[model samples]
Target chain A: MKLLLTGSAGFIGSHLAEHFLAHGHEVIGVDNYLSGQPRHTRHLLAHPGFSFVEADVSMGLPTDTGPLNWVLHFASPASPPHYQQHAIETLMVGAQGTQHALDLARRSGARFLLASTSEVYGDPQVHPQPEAYWGHVNPNGVRSCYDEAKRYAEAITCAYHREHGLDTRIIRIFNTYGPHMRPDDGRVVTNFINQALAGEALTVQGDGQQTRSFQYVSDLVAGIAALMALPGPHPHPVNLGTTDAITVLRFAQIVRDAIDPTLPIRFVPLAADDPRQRQPDITLARTLLGWSPQVSLTDGLTRTIAYFRALRAEQQPVPTSGPAWMRGAADAGQSAATPGD
Target chain B: MKLLLTGSAGFIGSHLAEHFLAHGHEVIGVDNYLSGQPRHTRHLLAHPGFSFVEADVSMGLPTDTGPLNWVLHFASPASPPHYQQHAIETLMVGAQGTQHALDLARRSGARFLLASTSEVYGDPQVHPQPEAYWGHVNPNGVRSCYDEAKRYAEAITCAYHREHGLDTRIIRIFNTYGPHMRPDDGRVVTNFINQALAGEALTVQGDGQQTRSFQYVSDLVAGIAALMALPGPHPHPVNLGTTDAITVLRFAQIVRDAIDPTLPIRFVPLAADDPRQRQPDITLARTLLGWSPQVSLTDGLTRTIAYFRALRAEQQPVPTSGPAWMRGAADAGQSAATPGD
Candidate 1:
């Protein structure tokens, strides 16, 4: 299989690229080094089957690539802080980037898989949200950048499937954390681990009662690959994440226990619009892909902690400030004009 | 107030324009005549201080009517059937059109008001959804063109406020019905009314237990004007419709009674992703706008019924098909890609 992987140097994208390359597929990895680092996929640079392109997918796909077998769109910021920082870019990549990839997939007749997120289910009312559950999203909130963009991206993808007869796959990915995650990715796992590793108190927001189910990246990639391999045009989104849910407080303790065993947890006020609970019901994934998460949270956390520790030991910058591209347009004074501006 | 009203020839837009015109405010009306009909605002054509521009805001605003005081962006295909007919156009207009309007508002230093919808709340979980209720939305569903597009529009609007300090108002309008509504509009009120008035059995989908809260167009326009006139920069949305909800079956019975005494009703399969129950909690509107829907459902229904009766009496050769622009697009086919095609 020949694959075009957008955001190939970002966390999940890099892992996905490695998985495909290791499986003997020729991989064309593309990233603007925006949120991604060269080192993430730099190891694959020497691999004959792995080639790289430095480009933004929103600008249009490379004009030269031949017809490909699969197009995995994993671009766009996933985390809250990252997306909020680059609102317009986040939106454009979701709109323009997804369209460009879908156009490529249509021309090449490849199965198109979009990496949708659980954030689409903003503070859901359902206990274990199913694939059919329409999300509870605040469109005008600070988090709208991620939630609304993913929402529109999913809609456009389905339109492409219905109107153009493209074979499309959509995965509503839940909280995923694993090795290669930035030391300060602003996600719970990375934040807790980095705090513990630095011998600092772990900051757990809002009494730590808010819950989330975190999927190990390996398990997430496994489900994605299997779903892509399946036949038929089931365009409905499938929830792809672990069902094991835990409160932020508990997760913080677990991380602290695994890393320092002595770090104290401090609580802070929760961010606006933060979900009280979120646990995906991956029944559809199990029934359709015959898959469930294989890695336990403890195992995943241990591996992730070790990866961060190694990077710290090597004195490598975790790129804590993020790539230059993650800076939101708001700060740059190039913020988009409203009807008046 | 000097107001810029997009889609000023459509149902709510035209009525709002007339209301503002009668109130002696300058109204700069713009419409591409997509779903808009000139006849709705036809009377205002001869009035001073009422200007109309035949242009698509999705591309960009035509001439910034310098130093405008208010902006009411009522563009985009609001009806479900109309939006579903031209999926891409719905998304584009909601996104790009809103963006252009937002830019224009920013440039002119005018307050921006976005006419969002109850569709933002999709098939809701809460009995009486509040202004802060994140919506239940299917990102990949068929109805997403309108639902998700409104969500995207609201998101961008909010971003403009938060990131750029734009003075913006968002009103999540519900099922508003009144005079000038397209005769065959697919909204339940119009659909049932048209069928009953035509001496045909009214169509009720599923068991008809699904509920909706209807806001009379006058009340909605009032709420919109109130919000737009609200001082300060509160970025949160305000639900502008009434909480007086009724089941679809009950509403159909009322429509049947109102239109024709002996009309029968038929049940059909519910449309995909249709909300089972929906009702807004307008506490915020009451507190914020000092507004609540003033017209009773029966009174509003009578007026809407009268308007449709007159429209039918005229034996107008108006197309009962779908959105005018979409119909034109399909008829023009190859030429549809060009502007003004």
Candidate 2:
């Protein structure tokens, strides 16, 4: 199989590209480093089947690419601070970028998959959100640039499926964390790990009772591979995430224990519109794809912490890192806007 | 004020065009005739202050429209059947068309007013939705093409306001029925009026107990003018709709009585995802803009019916009309996707 995978240097996108390439699929990776790292692309560049395009998907895909098989749209600044900082660009990538990808998929007669986020659920009213639950989303909030854009991407993906008979896939990925994640993308998971490793107090926002369901990236890629392997026209969005709900404080303790047991955990005020609890009802994924998260929070955090610690030893910073909103946010490190708390 | 308005040949666009023309503003109107009527443009062409540009906004706006004080983006196929059939176009206008409009607004240093919709609330969990209500919307549902598009439009509008410091105004219009609506735009209001006048049975989808707020176009125009008249940089969206909630059955009876009391009424199964009740929480509009609906239902229905009657007398079909799905949707004649149930 051959594929055009966008945002291929970003956290989840890079993982997805590697998975496909390892499976012997010819991969054309695209990214403008809006929030992606060069290291990931540089790593993929060593692979024989992987080619790269340095372009913004919102502008348009490369015209010369002889495409076949699939088009995966995974571009956009997914982190809260990144999207908020690049608000218009985020909206454009979701709106126009999604359209351009769909158009390419249609022209190439390739299956299309959009990298949607659980943020579509907003500060969900339902504790465990089923794909059937219409999301509760604020259309003009600070996060609207990301949330509404993903919702719009889902809308247009369905439109392409219905109108053009295009085979389309939508995955509403929940909070996911793993290796290859930036050391500081403003997500809670990374904030805790980096703080613990650096001997800084792990800052827990609010009382830290708020819980988030975090899926390991390997598990996420496994679910995607399963979904992609299935036959055509499964356009309904599928939720892929761990069902085990972990409170932010508990997760913070786990990260601190992995690095230094004495790392302090301090409480701070919670951010506005922060969800009290968010977990995915993954019944459909289990029933249809025979998939469930295999990696536990402790194991996932251990590996993620080791990766960041190694990067620190190398004296290299995370690539394309946005503003330093993370210095105090010992929150969920699953910040890449890819999937989050 | 000199202004640029897209969808000028549209139902509400034409009304808005006339409103500004009467106020002595130079208005350059753009429409691709996708869902807009040439006759509406013909009427406006006679006015010295009004000019028409034939173009699709999703493709791009015209280059020759000199400087502008305002950019009003009101384009798209709004009715359920119309939008569903032209699903891709609707998505483009809301996504790309909106961005294009915003770019021009930024370039001209003009104020931007986005004609959003109450449908953004998407079968609201909150009755009389306030501006602060986070909507319950199915991101991939049938109506998503229109609902999510408008939601996307609002997101991008806010992005422009926040990012480029572009002055922006957004009005979430509710069910507005008045003159210049297409006879067959498949909205509940016009369905009853046209059915009654043609001596056909009024088709009420369901027991018709579902209620909807109906605002006359004049009241809507007045609210828009108010929002536009405000000083620089009020970026938050304001609801510009009538708060009087009217049941579908009662609305049908009103339209029937206005045309002819002898007209028959029929009940059928309700459409899926149809809102049981919807009305605006207009406290903001009243408090901020000193605006309130002045047109009573009886008076508004009578005026609307008279206008359709005159159109029928002229023996000219509503121009640039789409499919004929309005035959049984007596749910609202306030079709055309401008604003409806």
**Which residue runs does candidate 1 get wrong by more than 4 Å?**
A209-211, A316-341, B41-44, B207-211, B246-262, B297-299, B316-341
Q: Quote the lDDT for B302 in model 2.
A: 77
Q: For each predicted model, how many residue pairs clash, with residues at least 3 apart or on different chains? A: 20, 20
Worst lDDT 10-window in candidate 1 chain B: B332-341
User: B1-341 in candidate 2: lDDT tens per residue?
Assistant: 99999999999999999999999999999999888887788777879998888999998987767788999999988888789889989999999999999999988879999999889998988888999987777888888999999999999999888778898999998888888888878889888888988999999988898999999999999999999998866888789888888889998888887778988899989876777887999999999899999999888887887787766655534344544554222122323332221
- Residue B69 CA displacement from its true place in model 2, Å: 1.5
Candidate 2 Cα misplacement greater than 4 A, ranges: A316-341, B316-341
lDDT of 1 at A282: 86
The digit string of per-residue lDDT tens for model 1 on B1-341 reads: 99899999888898889888888899999998888876655557888979899888787886659899998899888888888887877887777788889989999988998889888988887779887777777787789988998999898888888778899888888888888777657889889988988999988999998888888889988887777767888678888888898999999999999878798889999898888888889888898778988999999888888877765655534365768866554443212222110
Can you give the DockQ of every candidate in the order shown? 0.56, 0.75
Model 2, B201: alpha-carbon shift in Å?
A: 0.6
